[model samples]
Target: MESGPAIFAGTTFALFGAGLLLWTGARVLHREPVALGVRPSVSLISATLSGVVFLALGVWCFGRM
Candidate 1:
C-alpha cells in the first residue's frame, strides 16, 4: 500500500521550510536578527542558513517517497 503518513509529513515539512524562508527574508528586509530558540544570540546568517537546511530536508523527504 502507498504510504499516506509519509506524504503528509513531507508536505508539512516542506511548508514549514517555505514559511521559514519567507520569514527570514522579511527579517532581512527589516534589518532584524533571527533565532531558532536554541540560543540567545540571534544572527541573520544563521537564520538564512537554517531555512535552506530545512528546505533541503523537505525536498529530500519528498524524493525518498
Candidate 2:
C-alpha cells in the first residue's frame, strides 16, 4: 500500500492535470483565451501538448491510488 505522502502527491498531480485538461477543453470550446507568446498555431500546438502531458501525469498519479 502507498504511504500518505505518495497519496498526497498523487492527488496534487491529478488536480494539476485536471486543471490543464479543463483549460484545453475550454480553449477548444472557444470559451477561454488562446496562447499568446508565439504564433497562433504554435501556441495552440504547445497548449495541446501541455494539456496531454498534464492529463497523462494526472492519470498516472490517480493510478497510484
Candidate 3:
C-alpha cells in the first residue's frame, strides 16, 4: 500500500480533531449553553478524545512514512 494515502489521512484526521478541540474549548470557556440537548462536559470530553485519536493516528502515519 502506498504511504501517501496514510499520510494524507492522518493529517486530515489531525486537522479535524484539532478543530473540534478548539471549538469545544471555546464553547466551554465561553460558558455557552448546550445546544441539541448535549451536555457541556460531553462535548468537551468528546473533543478531547477526538484530538487524542487524531494525534495518535498522525504519529502512526508519520512513522510509516
Candidate 4:
C-alpha cells in the first residue's frame, strides 16, 4: 500500500533532516570550518529554515500513514 512508501520515505527524510540540523548546530557552535567544510560566513538562518522544512515534511509524511 501507499503507506509502505510513506513510511520508508518519511524515515529517510527524517534521518537526513536530523543530520542536517545537528551538523548546522555543530558548525555554528564549534566554529570549526574544517569540520563542516563550510565558510565562516555560512548563514545559520537559512540552515535553520531548511532543516525545519525538511523535518516538517518528514513528519507530515509519517502522519499520512
Candidate with best lDDT: 4
Better of 1 and 2 by TM-score: 1
Off by over 4 Å in 3: 33-35
Residue-level lDDT tens digits of model 2 in 1-65: 66676667767776776777677677868844567566767766777788777767766766766
Q: lDDT by residue for model 3 over 1-65, one digit each (tens)?
A: 69889889888877877777777677778888434477767766766887778877777777887
Q: Which residue pairs come into collision in candidate 1?
A: none
Worst 10 contiguous positions by lDDT, candidate 3: 33-42
Per-candidate count of clashing residue pairs (backbone under 3 Å): 0, 0, 0, 0
Q: Write the per-residue lDDT of candidate 4 for residues 2-65, one digit (tens) a residue.
A: 7999999899888888988999888777765523455555567667777888888899999999
- What is the Å distance of residue 12 in model 2 from its true position? 1.1
Superposing every Cα of model 3 onto the true structure, what RMSD results? 2.1
Q: How do the residues 6-41 of candidate 1 rate in per-residue lDDT, one tens digit apiece?
A: 677778778888898899788767866566454424
lDDT of each: 0.73, 0.70, 0.75, 0.79
Checking candidate 2 for backbone clashes, the offending pairs are: none
lDDT of 3: 0.75
How far in Å is the alpha carbon of 12 misplaced in model 3? Answer: 0.6
RMSD of each: 3.3, 2.6, 2.1, 2.7
Worst 10 residues of 2 by lDDT: 31-40
The regions of model 1 sitting more than 4 angstroms off are: 36-42
